[model samples]
Target: MQAWDDIINIAMIGTDKKQPDTISVPASLAEITTRIITGSEKNREEQFLQLASLLYNYQRCGISPLKKETAGTAAPVEEKKYCSTHAALALRDVLQDDNHSLLQYWLERCDSRTQIAPARFVPALLINGERNKKLRLLISSCVGKRGEWLSGFNTAWDFSAKQTQEEIWQTGSLEERQEVLQQTLVTDPLKAREWIRQTWQQEDAATKLVLLSILAPFADESDIDFLEGLSKEKSKKLQLFALESLRTIPGSPIVLMYESFLRSAVTIQKETSMLGFSKKNTLQCKLPDAVSEDLYKTGIDKLSSDKTWTDDEYVVFQVMQYVPPSFWEKTFQLSAEALLELFEKTDTGKKLLPALTKAAANFRDRNWANVIAQRRSVFQKELLPLLPLAPRDSYINHFFAKNINDVMDYAKETDEPWSMEMTRLILREAAKKPYPYVGFFQKVIAQIPVAVSTELSSYPVSEDQYSRSLWSGMSEEISRTLAIKNQINNAFTI
Candidate 1:
């Protein structure tokens, strides 16, 4: 195994030197060059010249050496011919069967450019996985220059340039540098965060805003300090965006952060209502006008019989929903019943109460389930009767229908009204499923009472019933059973 591994590793490196993996190279130089040229927008001429010059210098004898020549004389014909000859030789040496030679040559040129002696550094920050301080310093130089160099690469360079670009981000401008920082942070989050901190104050407000925006992509608990600082901004927009960013760091101490802010600036009060709920200790905080408006628009309608809300309000309420139940213990101790009553009175009791209960349940609060159950009971009792019966079982409404199903789960505790309703649905569904005991369905059919069989005469019939006698000889019991089965089958088919 060891010998095989050694052979495989050796095959990976261009030299017989053992390495890790095979490189995935772009198919052609024209493709890579086209990507570089078309993808870049900044310093186009300079970048182009820089790339061409680097390629030229790295090519075998491609560059004409500056050597002693007769002053004011163009008599170095031999040298020019030799330079072309060597360039062709170098091209052959570098390009022949080399998959990643383009990147290798680029790195060699970069190393030569930064050399102080025979010893020189290359763009090995990503390649060698080294923490050499010079590599970080070089990255800083790129960032400080506003990431002007990054535009020259495209998706085709993702493999070769990915690491070097990321390392350079440690030095890249805070706002301009986020593009590079994005790739590295996923693999080395702690170091990426530290890099952000080292340059935090040096970045301007706009740059800070851009840097914070990326927090949602790769935020962790360690980012709380940076977020807290940004959240305290005097600008409302910045404060909102910062708060929004903190939301991405799930299970973090964001609520404590939010609570502190609310305590300083906002208050919530409860209003009396006919629904038997009135309490002053409501959870309240004022977001920016837009967020507040969004919450209001998304909250369940106060007058809708459905008692359901849209998805956006739930997202706005998610911060409270994710808070550990223990955090609410103090409130529970003060007046658990009062809090419960307030939840019932809230406009979105059906939606908010259940979520609030579940979140509290995580802390072993027994009342969480009890409170949600109580609200659920009122909802089932009051609203179940008004739900429309779909002519067919719809896939889209399956979940909502399921919720109602749970509320009215068969054989559970129920009054006559509910029992009667379920019996009707069961008969209707049973008929569709071809259940044999169609005669046993008298309870539901009797309640329907309109004599659907006789009523068929008053409705439109086939122009010639004699010829359309599809069920002419069937007994009443068999005919009724077949009709019910057909209807139920049709319902599900739709």
Candidate 2:
């Protein structure tokens, strides 16, 4: 191809300008030259493939010849000269420019590896640049030899652990080839879970735990059983990991299993408040009478007085998180007046009331309405004024918005971050939208906080530095558009 010849001639001409004996080819030209030197001559398609690869290499990776001289011995021996790599870099300057159009000519000339490559830098060629197609070809060519490629495109310049993992996962066969799979799981929870499900029975306990580590991304109700099954294994760490993982899944069936044990072992510790003492020394958390009260019979209250079962907050929070809000509704059914009396008696009772309100919403109970009506006068006069400035205000808002829609509307009017987050959650829950905080999204985007703004702005600077930079910038732009679409969908749902 003329382009290849031009590239080689330019490198030879620039040898003196670059450095003695160093023929520095420009970015795309070096690749073109390499293709001409190494390409097969049998078919048009094959030759074109070679040319395409050469162009990619030159534009993306640059040329390979650099002359390195040995240290002087002064004995007049022939100089140790390495090949010059400068030719590869010069081509980059041309490829990176917006108007330097070579892709059309390159595509037409190499359309098919031919006995003789086409001569026309074909003006009428119907080639349009495509990223995904080019990427697929690049991946097919570079799959196993990533380390070599990485040397040319250093990690600092093109770091993509996800891509590296994908290459191995798509090509490698060994399940025990743990690095790629482990990293995949660590970074992508859904992918890791699917990987585990695909290869679970075949893996050992240690491997299972490694796979389970991916579930750390977001815990849900379904993870409980997977964790519980591991608890039967002899490895205490695996069992513990399983047990710990269950706490994160909010609506998990695992709670029913642990509920009885907890009720029996734990007790309601006495608590006090700055508001002053009431008639009762200890507040009672009343429960609704149930046909199958067995669920409420966890021995946790029995051990409340004992200090022996101290564990991490995550452990306690696990049960607390999953324990259905409906349970509090049942407690209210026993005696609404008694519950009010208890709320007045202790600080813990005050904390427990909002939780009860949430439970009332979940269960859709009218008792909560009656209780609110009875306390309306005192609540408005005292509690309502202190709510915004109170230490537990955020928590109160969170619980109320979670359990009650009216309260969420109130928060929306206030337009605080907590309100925005709650609104987002509600939008996701009720409207099936991905992110409901449309206003919040708009606000943040318009005047992004300083902490995250600068990194966002300079993302495009790389491509001008390397022809490779252009491709990278294009890819990033596409990803940002997709992200914006997802946010828009979420806003609509909200």
Candidate 3:
């Protein structure tokens, strides 16, 4: 028989160039090969095709692959804590669909209770972790031993890799350095501070501010000298960073400096109103009885030209922001609640409320945030992040009856999941008012877990065709979205 290599050789040049296969025949194929090689039974190309067909038939029936040595090693089975089915399904559903809001919820649950997600979910989590920096820690925690093993294959997902923290600090990009610095501060604040101190003068203004901002967590009187030195810098941004860091450590010299400056200009005053017995006396925020030429230049002096408020009122608002919110409680001889309430009664309180709430949000005082929510219809948006995550699933549980869009905006800003009660509230309101965008409502609904929204499955019932048509269409969208989610739930671990 002709060798297979000889057949390949004739095929390479094509029948047009040379007809080696047609010119010669193997001993075994001498009879049929003679017909194609010498006979006019088929032309050169046709003859080549017939030869190829015979080989194909022979190989399928005759050829057999030899048993060979084993291939590359399988990935080691990681022994790790497996998440519950509910948790696993929840993670998969949110992750696969790009439901960031719910993914945030899932990550939070994993973080709070040390829940490890399924191995299958790790790869996707790693991919997503590269997309959003904030989720890196939570994703790392959920990734388990197997996921860590997988991260080495992709540089983007290497957040969990252990390296010389100093290397990252010295050579990493600004974002990379900040991430390393944040972790360093958590583990060893002194080392973090030293790193900043070494690079302080060498770094540019933007980098310097970035480094200074992360110092707040571990800031103390020890950091005061460095910050004070920064205060002397010509860059206003640099000086602002120094002042902000100083405010974190209440007893720091910088805060004390501001405190001393304000001690004389601000004081508590009680006023008596003789109009009615019910309105006898209440405290008022009082400024200096007399103003001197020195007062106007310092923030201690009233300084705004706008008629909306007095110069003294404007100055007090500015001073309240810098000083600790606690200072007012002691200065006014009122508790935080009473002080905030007393301020609410005055027009000056309305102007100053934002500043005081800012201090509260910065200091992470929940009491201050709550009291603001109590008295005012609106609270500072920044305060929500200072609140804990994965709050028993229903903490921000109800949507206010009015201001549906505002409530939704607040929910998104906080990155917290809306409770089913809240979702139901939104749907019920939509059924009544018919929210303008069906697609937006559909997307938001998809993020909510099927389990949580079980009771809200059926909604917006109506007899009128227009109203009925709208509700029915929205219901169908929810149905289709949840049906796919249900399929995923069945297909997934939890």
Point to the candidate with the largest lDDT.
3
Q: What stretches of model 1 exceed 4 Å from their correct place? A: 1-166, 170-180, 202-207, 217-221, 231-236, 245-254, 257-348, 354-494
Clashes of 1: 5
lDDT of 1 by residue, 1-494 (tens): 23234333444653324322212222333454455445557355444444354334434353466654333443211211111233223323323322132223322333333421111111222222123222333332222111212212322212223245555565433433665666557777777787778877777777767777775656656776777687567666667776655544544555554333323322346556677576454544343333333233322222333336444334434545444444444534545555557656546444455555545533334444444343342322222322333311221123334454444342133222323344334334333332333333332222222233333223232345542242222124333533443332232233
Candidate 1, residue 87: lDDT? 28
lDDT of 1: 0.41
lDDT of 3 by residue, 331-427 (tens): 6667887877766666767677787888776666776666665555345555555544433122343225444566566654443445565566666
- Ranking 1 against 3 by lDDT, winner: 3
Alpha-carbon TM-score of each model against the true structure: 0.28, 0.31, 0.59
Q: Using TM-score as the measure, which candidate wins?
A: 3
Candidate 1, residue 390: Cα displacement in angstroms equals 26
Worst 10 residues of 3 by lDDT: 390-399
Kindly report which residue pairs in candidate 3 clash with one another.
85-494, 302-311
lDDT of 2: 0.39
lDDT of 3: 0.65
